[model samples]
Target: MIWNLGSINADNFYDLPHLPGPGETLTATRFRQGLGGKGANMSVAAARAGARVMHIGATGADGRWAAQRLFEYGVDIPHVAEVDSATGHANIHIDPQGENSIVIFAGANADIDEQMIGAALSEARPGDTLLLQNETSGQVYAAKTAKALGLRLIYAAAPFSAAAVAAILEDIDILVLNAVEAGQLHAATGRELDALPVGDVIVTLGSDGCKWISNTARTTRLFPAFPVVPVDTTGAGDTFTGYLASALDRSLPMPQAITLASRAGALMVTRRGTADVIPDLREVQDHDFG
Candidate 1:
């Protein structure tokens, strides 16, 4: 089972000819709304990849539909509480090149408390996976609880926070971060990539691929990205993280899990949209990487 202490967001996407410059106002050619948030997206991705996923997060009454949507994707959401605050949301501006600039408002996502986290984690057993992101509150508590419970803690260090990462670093079993985030983390810690204290670190390179640094083996391996023409790179990283976690939970080896995750991420960028467009396991399996 995979327990996600994550965020749920109402993603608002605007398609524009080009990203707006500072103080520049431009009209978007199209606008669409969908389910999003790193936590929500990864939960959906894990479910679609055939893992038993439980999403532990909060959403506002107005965002109840977002929680309901997770049901359709096969994510268990008994721990998702409806709070008094507005639903968290993102305003995403996508340019013709498939690059995007985003502004996030953490509303109900910031309302996660220790009580909620404890209640959700109580259902998890030892050896189950606990996944976390920086989008929501209670991460430190979640990390501590998961550690005490003997769960395998996986941290996706996104929207990078030095304090947050430092607080949970000792508790995390596997650490995943994208290239830019890795750079920032390196800057914050004043350590080389391989010298981090974590046992396993995976750094994702957008087009080039991913790098795996195994502290246990004292070795690093590079896994190349599957080639694809990207339409919108919005949720590719989340898709990769979700699939990777699911693969790991199923007892797949690190190399195999990374290969499958690379496929899922490559497939994600071929389409548009966020959580709505994540590829299912069958779609990924049928994809001809050749």
Candidate 2:
């Protein structure tokens, strides 16, 4: 089982001709709302990829539907608490090319606390998988607790925070990052990707591919991305992370797991929306990377 301590968001998408510049006003071409949040997306993605996923987080009463949506997507949400704050939401603006800019309002996602985390971790056993991202609070506490419990911890450093990474770096087993985020971390820590004190580090390069650096093996290898025309790049990384976590949880070798994850990410960019659109394991396996 995979335990995910993450945020749930109502993603509000606005279709624009181009990303709006500062102080610029432009009419939107279209609009839609869907389930999203770095944590929620990964949870759905991991669950869809065949892992028994348990999502631990808080949502507001107004956002009850999002939690229900997660349950419908195959994630176990018995630990998801309904808090007093409003549910979190994201304002996402997308261009014709599927490039996006987003602003987030962290409401109940920020209300997560030690008690919630402790209660959730108590339900997990040793060797269970734990997935975390920067969208929610109590990550450090959760990471440390999960580590002590002998869980295999995977961290998706979206909305990357160097301080947060530093606080829990020792507890993480796998670290996932985008190209830009990887650079930011390197610059902040003054260490190369392979030098980071973690078991494995994954740097995802959009379209080009991803790099896997293993500290234990002292090796770094590149896994090429599958070629596909992209419509919405949003959540592609989350799809990759979630699928990778699922593959890892199943004990697939790194190369095979990355191949599966690459296929999922390739498929993800071909669609729009976030958690709602993550492909299932069968879809990923059946997808022709060619």
Q: Which candidate comes out best when scored by lDDT? A: 1
Model 1, position 43, has a per-residue lDDT of: 99
TM-score (C-alpha, index-matched) for candidate 2: 0.93
lDDT score of residue 160 within candidate 1: 100
Residues 129-217 of candidate 1 have per-residue lDDT tens digits of 99999999999999999999999889999989999988999899999999999989989999887888888999999889999999989
The candidate maximizing TM-score is: 1
Clashes of each: 0, 0
TM for every model, in the order presented, reads 0.94, 0.93
Model 1 — which ten-residue stretch has the worst lDDT? 190-199
**Residues forming the 10-long window of minimal summed lDDT in candidate 2:** 188-197
